[model samples]
Target: MNIHIIWDEANLPIIKSNLSNVIDVIDDTIAVSFDTWLFSSNGEFVIEFYHDGQTIIGLK
Candidate 1:
């Protein structure tokens, strides 16, 4: 299953939990939650997105 692709809305919370816990500002919604933060362990910055029970994480 592609995380970027939107699916059932019921999975939103689960997806968000998997990608949760970061120093990022997020505007959460039923369809999608968007956030961005830097990984303190390695200074590896990331942009995290959760939508409809799917998760997409990107590094920068």
Candidate 2:
């Protein structure tokens, strides 16, 4: 499946400069919730969705 990433203008530049070639740019709603599962080297935690340029450093 193709993952669509919605980002704000401020973060767009950086994302574009960096991850644009990797991920697809999405302009629609980014859905997340307390039920959302996130895992990293640090640990696991619940997460929510935001569109203002947050760095995603873990599980896709």
Candidate 3:
């Protein structure tokens, strides 16, 4: 099974720091990240169902 994630705005500094490391490596003008602040849902917690259902927000 798979689940989607949302990045909590509360964690952006950590995200920027991590991205900066990647930018230093790739040496580019624009910075981007393909990282996630894990869900702790790795077969450990039961996922909830919402009335709207099934959106793939892809921090995959």
Ranking by lDDT: 1, 3, 2
- State which candidate, 1 or 2, has the greater TM-score: 1
**Model 2 / residue 18 / CA error / Å:** 23
RMSD of 1: 11.5
Model 3 Cα lDDT, one tens digit per residue, 1-60: 332332434554432233335335532311222333323234343222222433222242
- What is the Å distance of residue 22 in model 3 from its true position? 18
How well does candidate 3 score on lDDT at residue 8? 35
Query: Native-vs-model 3 lDDT?
Result: 0.32
Q: Which ranges in model 1 have alpha carbons more than 4 Å from their true place?
A: 1-43, 47-49
lDDT of 3 at 14: 33
Cα displacement (angstroms), candidate 2, residue 4, comes to 11
- Model 1 has an lDDT value of 0.34
Candidate 2: global Cα-lDDT?
Answer: 0.31
Give the Å error, residue 15, model 1.
18
Compared with the true structure, all predictions reach lDDT values of 0.34, 0.31, 0.32
Candidates sorted by TM-score, best first = 1, 2, 3
Stretches off by above 4 angstroms in model 3 are 10-35, 40-60
1-60 in candidate 2: lDDT tens per residue? 222333334434211122333334222323322122222323342233444546344443
